[model samples]
Target: MKLRRRAGLFAILAAIILAIAYGFMPKPLPVETAEVKRKYMRVAIEEEGRTRIIDRFIISAPVAGFARRIELDAGDPVSKGEAITELEPLRSNVLDPRSRAEAKARVAAAEASLRAVKENVHAAKASAEFAKKELDRLRQLFKDALVAQEKLDEAETETRRTAAALRSSEFAVEVARHKKAAALTALKYSAAREPEEYAERVIIKAPVSGRVLRINHKSEGVVNRGQPLIEIGDPQALEVEADLLSADAVRISPGTPVLFERWGGDKLLKGRVRVVEPAGFTKISALGVEEQRVLVISDIVSPPGMWAELGDGYRVEASFILWENDNVLQIPASALFRYGDGWAVFVFSNERARMRKVQIGYRNGLSAQILSGLAAGDKVITHPDSSIKEGARVRLRKERTL
Candidate 1:
């Protein structure tokens, strides 16, 4: 009986020790996981874009004058050749002392030039009269058989040449007079003498039939020639401009499909790449990073009434399709980790973590293409950490969904 009790006690002590050892062993790590699956996958580049009129026109003041108050606002319909605004000559622009002096000198020079031209005209006229008389005399001599026909022809040619010279001198005088007038106008002397006379209304007309987009001048004011007055464009003819990173733009080509969204409409609009500008510009990102960007122009291919409410400068999101497949083996991008020069994933099998080297093709922010080293229905440990090691025992925190 003593031997039996001793044996039973020893067996109980051994069982207790074994139980303590088992309790001290490291417990399986609990991890969140996802199942790899075959699904439709696509790789695309997305960026914010804006709508713009393809044929925008800016109307500028045709002449420097007093621009009347523009009653027309943006979006106002305008017809081709229809007057949009009137500019009446205001008291000529104020001239500085130096400018006034220069104007006076120019005016005097022009008057002197005009007098010289007038004298030249008189001299040409006198020569022409002398030539005509000589020609008549020669013709009379030729008729009497005293002078040769060649001499008569020479006299007639001289008369014609002198007449042309007189006409040229007269034109020069007119040009000089115009110069004098311009000089006087520049000095503002004409305005000072006949202010009301300079108030003749000059009408400005629309160059094309379209709606006004912008107005630079609204109130009556003086404007210089070539100053912008309004912008006009056909709202129906619209395109989209997207600035993309230079790296992404290189992959885009003309005629690539595009999807436009978040443009204040429930339905998505369609567009196609028209051009990838050959040049790039430097842009500062919101995070203060300098980025090289290229312009990607896209034509709105959707029919009217679909995005009828869309207008110039409206913001939209654009997605440029790069590559896509209807069915592809894909895994969460988070499942991938850098391994050597390639990529790897922590695959879950037999309730343990297995290091896997994977060949990846394309990847976006959310998912990645699995070209090899993984199969459909395989479970991967998402967000793997240092605690996960080769052959490390793992327990699912919850059932992983495909």
Candidate 2:
């Protein structure tokens, strides 16, 4: 009876120990994954920049004056030869009265001198004619031997002296006429007239038909010569000015296609590289590093109606298409992994993670072109974690939580 009781107790302890071990056993954790879909991909470099009009004009003050009234503001339409701004004539209350009086007196004096010289010329001409006639009579008398040679000689000398006096009077007349003309010209300058005078209050006109972009002068003020007053540009004609690194600029050529965006538009605008400027300048980046920058001028390929809402100096983003390929198999950049000397990816197969090495082509920030080792409809792990290993059995979750 004792042996039978001991056997029953040992059997109960063993059964209890087996039940506790079963409850402490681990359960398989679920994992999520994705399939690799083949699609066309593009590799692009993005940059932040601003929009600009291809042809911009800076209208400046032709003369210094108080910029009394600016007839237009930014975005105002102006026609060719239109008056955009009016400047008040600079008036000075301190004009010397004696200066005006002296000018008038000089004019009168010049006129009087001219009249006197004319009279002198007339008298001299008459005297010269008389002297010539007297010399002819004396010569005739000498030839006929009716007078002494000495008397003929005296008459000849007197005629010569009168001819010299007449010539002197003629020169004096010419000098006086020139002086009078000069005095009249000076008088005209003193009385400055509108449109004819190159002085203050010069009307600045628009050289071309366009919209006003900037107005530097706000109130009535004086501007020096050659100072900028306003900027103008054609609203219909617009282009983008891109500042590219010098190294990248060398690879870009004219006629290359470009994609533009964020110029106050929801859709991307198309454009072409029109010009690559030969000059380059130094520019400091946001990190305070100095770099050489080159300007590239591009023409908007999109219709004018699309960009009509855009104004001058609007900010825009541009992407230059250095190269492109169509119908190429590609995958997301996250799906790739560096294995040994080549690239590899985790391809889902047989309900487990399979390690497959892949040959990669061109790779951008977003996608990578798969040359081999991957095909369309292959499920690959995008976000791989250390817990996942090669040949590890995985159950495809219905939803991708990551």
Candidate 3:
């Protein structure tokens, strides 16, 4: 019986010791883990972009004239040399009473000038006729040897002078008549301002084959020379313009591959960078942040049919691939943490967290290239908190609740 009592006491003491030890032992930390693997990795800069025509032609008014109402709407197809607009003579500006009186007086004065020129022409004709008669008489007398040769020459010279003076007077009459007519047209234009009143119209034609993009003025109105009238561009020829932050722009150069998305198309449009503009401009973002941006132009390399509907000023999301690798060792970016002037990760091994210093190469926002210290199939803790330390016990986060 004493032996049996001793055995019972020893069993109770063993149970108490085990309970105490269990209480003091460190608990395995619940951690999310990811595996290191090989993947086709790409480092890209993403930003919103816009689609624009490769060559945009802006048709402007060729002269200051009254434009006919634009019959073509935006998106209307146009062929090269097709007449798109007709410009009539500009409507006269509203004339004040004083100006109107002056115009009327000018018209009267031009009429008077024309009448005076006609009288002068008539007088010149009379003088020419009399001089010709005298010359004919002198010629008869000279032929009969009854007049001196010098006298006949003088008569011929007077006849020629009168003939030339008559011609000059006739020319002056025509000029005066033109002046009078111009003054009349100006006076009449104030009352008559219709398309039919204009003698001729200036027809503006499309310089290239394309669709009309914008119509600056649709209604008939006076347009000045060099004023933008319509914008035309070929929709099939598409290019992308992405405004990237200056810092990101420097990392990319010409020939960088680009992918366009969310541009109202089913296929992913592809392109290559054509130019990185040397100049930078200040832009205000939606967040009201002042950002220095550079324009990166890209040519769409895909077939025209893929993005045929895309026209100027269409929005798109552009991904500029700065670097790429066919197959690369990579891990979740969250798995890495700063460690002593380098980088480190807590690798899950044998149910414990093992701190490992690693060399990393390229890093996208979501993933990083593992240059060293990590291998394929290695599991590492991601989002490690302060509780995680070297040699600490850990378990797959799914295995337990927080």
TM-score for each model = 0.72, 0.65, 0.78
Which candidate has the highest TM-score of all? 3
lDDT of all predictions: 0.90, 0.78, 0.91
Q: Which parts of model 2 have CA positions greater than 4 angstroms off?
A: 1-32, 65-68, 86-90, 93-201, 324-326, 385-388, 393-402
- Predicted candidate 2 versus true structure: per-residue lDDT over 1-53, tens digit per residue: 99999999999999999899978864333455555566666666556666687
Q: Write the per-residue lDDT of candidate 1 for residues 160-222, one digit (tens) a residue.
A: 999999899889989989988987778665344555544478888989999999999989988
Q: Tell how far residue 307 is off in model 2, in angstroms.
A: 1.9
Pull out the clashing pairs in model 2: none
Clashes of each: 0, 0, 0
Prediction 2 global C-alpha lDDT:
0.78
Q: In model 1, which regions exceed 4 Å deviation? A: 1-8, 92-199, 399-402
| Lowest-sum lDDT 10-residue window in model 1 | 190-199
Lowest lDDT 10-residue stretch of candidate 2 = 191-200
